[model samples]
Target: MTEVTEAGVSKAGVDEAKAAMREIFPETPLQMNEHLSRRYGADIWLKREDLSPVRSYKIRGAFNFFRKAIAAGAKDRTFVCASAGNHAQGFAFVCRHFEVPGVVFMPVTTPQQKIDKTRMFGGKFITIRLIGDIFDQCYAAARKHVEETGGMMVPPFDDRDIIEGQATVAAEIVDQLPEGVIPDLVILPVGGGGLSSGTTGYLKDVVAPENFIFTEPEGAPSLKKSLLAGEPITLAKLDNFVDGAAVARIGDLNFAALKTFSADQVMLMPENAICVTITEMLNVEGVVLEPAGALSITVLEALGREKLAGKTVVCVVSGGNFDFERLPDVKERAMRYAGVKKYFILRLPQRPGALRDFLNLLGPDDDIARFEYLKKSARNFGSILIGIETANPENFAGLVERFETAGLGYEDITENEILANLVI
Candidate 1:
């Protein structure tokens, strides 16, 4: 296959892709987010890809891939893909729309919510196979099946056609904006780099490349690390919390499209900070965003109000296939990041007055969210796991001062990932 050049993703190609996309679904809304705009002191517009049919921009690529393949007179009618997230759902939805047979491979440990949704979208047009314990293993199995069966493989990213299809998002953004107004910045969240690369490619043709900013999860800084190294580098480990954007390596075609950019163009967003954005969006704007979908909005903090003031910014809200089961975890992480909640291991004396003394130390705004005895059988002292939520972070300092004054023994384990994971 020929390399995807900057010239390859031309205005005409993107326009064609957009026109083809109109047959499937209407353009996602590009709404001026009043809350975010007021907070940042900028005109912040959100391209709501989360509102897409599959709750993501993945459908655009999947649909375009299928449309182009069939149009090319390819004999292989069967399609196969491996994904445990939005891609699988998008591919399945496209398969149903195109009326083509599809085989989707997902890890055995894939959540039932995602599996059921994929099945629901594909209906009778697709068959899902739960194969491996991990994504790499599932992907390998999918490749082997396609190799043996002579079926077409719909890669999550890395293909020119897929990139072209994803570029339609940029086309829509440009067309949807009010006439005579150009955005000063466009924030894109990068995973395998399909969305970022495609959107940046098209936007560069119409606008300046300097106007683009790419974001990736801090734990999975694939594009940022690759750009810094001047080559694609696979990460040894990735925090899959941002499941939709935690790519170990940027796709080859995607990197090719983005290679000329400097590392400073990409911002690494902390997973916890993203949770804060998710919670804020949910509570303030009544918008539910998955971790990946929240990346663009979360990075606005890193951008700073000084730089963003009076600028017209567009944030691509990538996906909203959030599992509500993770809401508690999200809330906990958000609180911790906001400094309003913390966990501590308290060594309480085995006496009746000790519990009351510790309780009295808490400020009026402080509340104990969790209390559990770890080593209750101890003769002198008992190990107590305590979770505290406070209105202000300064309340913790006062409580800690009280602990010192009272000679109470305690260890704050709020920021200790290992200990918190084991107990909290």
Candidate 2:
């Protein structure tokens, strides 16, 4: 392996990388958020990585990788990478900026919006291949392509150069802080562990590792699982809804960079809970966030105001490449997580007043979101698939209590994962 010093990847090298990034874009804003501060009773700041040219800090790593690689005499190298979302755009943006030829391998399941944005960023400088259903499979395709074509692989988060590039985010954060305002806690969202590892590695001296909380999608807790296992581990299944941070396995290099931290430092954030934060930020603050971008912020509630009281916390709002088309689904998930929405199968009587009786059971705050009959399963018994939206979540308890008291049999399908996916 080429030494990182030769690749410009030391602590001072990260500072140099940040300075070099000015050619592509200026420093992303580090703004103190009064709304979150008041809500959590703590001083909360946002490292707005979402405001970058690619709408993510991934650009930093990509730019640094290319800069160091080309500078170390690989100027004519053809680069390739595999990514589900944010990293693709970053690699594309850097490729275009350098006028370098490159190819991006993306999962077939990646959002169309992300694919389009990546093409828009790379322009004529890059080619995109939709290779597999998941990032890991896509990554394998990318690697195989690299070996066949003899092209340099610009790994998304698995190389020393990549980590060094990502470490520039830490440099920017420290530089952008207000005078005498040291952060008490920092929350980072982990996908393949590049950002968390790089940032923590660079801040090893300044920020105590215990003060950092690394977050992962609850459905894909690779970092936490790896920490417990003492080595990198691949997840058998991964939920791609949080596409930006949904890696099946944490990068070996990135995991090595983060191995010092205990498994307890990793927090698994529920995918639905992240949706709650996304909807809340969009509705209350007009800040759009993809599920992965909302990961750091969503964990704030889990930490509670008590843990955050009087402390200075920095949340990295990592990316904003959210597809508006997914907004309805996101809102639905959010509402369900907030307990203001539910789906159930009501045993409605087929008699004339039977429907009216069931309707009468609902409180004034409840509204029917969906009312559908799923065929007659038995004599005079049709499965009434009903979705309810209410002002207060508690109203459903009353509705369910009434149903049981009246000898009406029903099933709450909201928490039934299989039924929720198949029918709801």
TM-score of each: 0.97, 0.96
In model 1, which range of ten residues has the least summed lDDT?
1-10
- Cα lDDT, model 2, residue 13: 76
RMSD of 2: 2.4
Native-referenced Cα lDDT, model 1:
0.92
lDDT of each: 0.92, 0.88
For all candidates, the clash counts are 0, 0
Best by lDDT: 1
lDDT (tens digit, per residue) of candidate 2 on 261-314:
889989998889999999989888899887888999998999999999999998
* Candidate 2, residue 303: how far the Cα is off, in Å: 0.7
